[model samples]
Target: MAGDGVRGQETAVLAGGPADGMRITVADRPAVLQVTRPCVVEVPFGDVRVDGLYVYRRDLRVDEEPLRYGFDPASP
Candidate 1:
């Protein structure tokens, strides 16, 4: 989840899909944001009552050039 200062805050993210090339927008007010990587994640074969799932990968991209901060699941 990505957010501003404090322990609890709102977050948002832009997610993408694998085969279908679908995009998901995550906006959680007063909560946390979750972005699921399509290729690395395992989606259920059938209709599942879950948003999405991602496999923990060490090679995950954290930040882009000029951006000091990086994307770390352990952080926030």
Candidate 2:
């Protein structure tokens, strides 16, 4: 994997670090990265293969509003 998080022929894997507080996995239907904790994730300019993926570009906002999604599952 490239240290710069850029694409080549190799791929980069994102997962929980040694601190044991993160769990990286893919979501279903409306595809989004579901991370267990608040951590900084960097992806290379490579292939992001999701089986049934539906994603928007970084510029797309929700309801034409600012990006205001949180990871807190308890919240409404």
Candidate 3:
């Protein structure tokens, strides 16, 4: 499971939006997040929790390269 994807409490990069390229702490393994009430994740900047839409795009073993949220505007 070392290179299968991002594990819990790991830093992942934001795919888009204002948080794009920003790093955040992943609270859940497999990165399962609700798009409806979207979970608040802790960003590296002052550990502030940002509220936004996060969709699971893929899994990566590399740090700061994995996408925590794709934030597709077309999605409902």
TM-score, per-candidate, Cα-based: 0.21, 0.17, 0.38
* TM-score of model 3 vs. true structure: 0.38
Query: How far is 67's C-alpha from truth in model 2 (Å)?
Result: 2.8
Task: Provide C-alpha RMSD values for all models, in order.
Answer: 10.1, 16.6, 10.1
| Regions of model 2 farther than 4 Å from truth | 1-32, 36-62, 74-76
Top-scoring candidate (lDDT)? 3
Off by over 4 Å in 1: 1-28, 40-72
What's model 1's TM-score?
0.21
Distance from true location, Cα of 65 in model 3, Å: 6.8
Number of clashing residue pairs, candidate 1: 0
Cα error, candidate 1, residue 6 (Å): 19
* 1 versus 2: better TM-score goes to: 1
lDDT for model 1 comes to 0.31
Best by TM-score: 3
Question: Where does the lowest 10-residue lDDT sum fall in candidate 1?
Answer: 62-71
Query: What are the Cα lDDT values of the candidates?
Result: 0.31, 0.29, 0.52
